[model samples]
Target: MTERRPRKDAVRNRMAVLAAADALFNRRESPEDLTMADIAAAAGVGKATLFRAFGDRTGLLRALYEARLEPTMDAVKAGPPPLGPTTPPLARIPALLDALLCFKLDNRRLALALEGTAGAGPYRAANYERWHSLLKVMLEQIPGMADSDFIAHALLAATRADLVEHLAGQERVPPERMRTQLAAFTARVLGTRPTPGSNAED
Candidate 1:
């Protein structure tokens, strides 16, 4: 016997819940301020449906975060040069790090909430592993680059949501300056001088 698929309305309701949660997350001062009930009401679904769909707040946050990151992840996986597999390692490494930094910067609040969720270390996250694996592979291709695993972790550390929040929020660093700084930093880790004018401050 064939198994039944989710009904069309069920799929639509799921999408609505995710969309409502996304909007609520962006509008609220903090994700902690939003509740499952609030999301259900906004999505026009019942509280039971929300809980059944996502399991819990952390699960919901993870789903929403992943949804938002899907586009960039797709680019890194199979899109154009600099991010895709076709790009040279030396160039791709910095591009990957820069992309991650920009992503965290753009999704500051959501990232902070997702990473800060109880029992959810970014290192253990599925998306984090995908990025680390890709970076490690790229680093291994570069000449004289030892400890690619550790190096990948270190580079990802620089783009952590809390660190990005500190620099962009409390320190008031401009987005362009932040990107340039990360580019320069990545270049240093890869033992290459950033191209002239890439550092923004140069």
Candidate 2:
């Protein structure tokens, strides 16, 4: 039997739900403040429809997060240097961490909500494993880098959503400054000297 496609109306409703949820999540300080009912209302669909489209609140959040991450993930996978396959591992390592940090900063509340969910933290997420594996492979390519697996995990820890929130929200560190600090710290971890005039020190 041929696979049945989703109805056109179902596709439209799904898009509406995602767009509404994206807007609400972006405007709110915390995703915990929003609900499936709220999303359904915002999307002009029944709560049942929302649940049917996405199994639950966690599922919805995962879909939204994945949608937002897709472009960046694609770039990292196949785009130009610094994030693509062509960049030297040493350069790519720091670049990847920086990209992750920026992504966390941009999606602070959503990242926190998703990563802090019950029964499944950030480490359990598929994207987290993908990033860890990528970082580990790159670290392995660098001369004298030991324990690439542990090092990759350690490096990623610096960009955790909660940590980014703590530094950006509570501490009020400027975005550029936070990036600089992370770069400096990453350089130290890799035992590489920072580039001259690089804000890694600032």
Return the top candidate by TM-score.
1
Model 1 Cα shift for residue 67 (angstroms): 1.0
lDDT to native, each model: 0.87, 0.89
lDDT of model 2, residue 39? 96
lDDT of 2 at 15: 94
lDDT of 1 by residue, 102-170 (tens): 889989999988888745557766578888898898889998899999999999999988899999999
Residues 1-202 of candidate 2 have per-residue lDDT tens digits of: 9999999999999999999999999888779999999999999999999999999998998889999999889989998987999998878888888889899998999999988873556898657899999999998889888999999989999998889989999999999888888889988998876544557782
Model 2 bad stretches (over 4 Å): 1-4, 118-120, 195-197
Error of 1 at 165 (Å): 0.6
Q: Ten consecutive residues with minimal summed lDDT in candidate 1?
A: 193-202
Please tell me which predicted candidate would have the highest lDDT against the true structure. Answer: 2
- Pairs in steric clash, model 2: none
Model 1 quality (TM-score)? 0.93
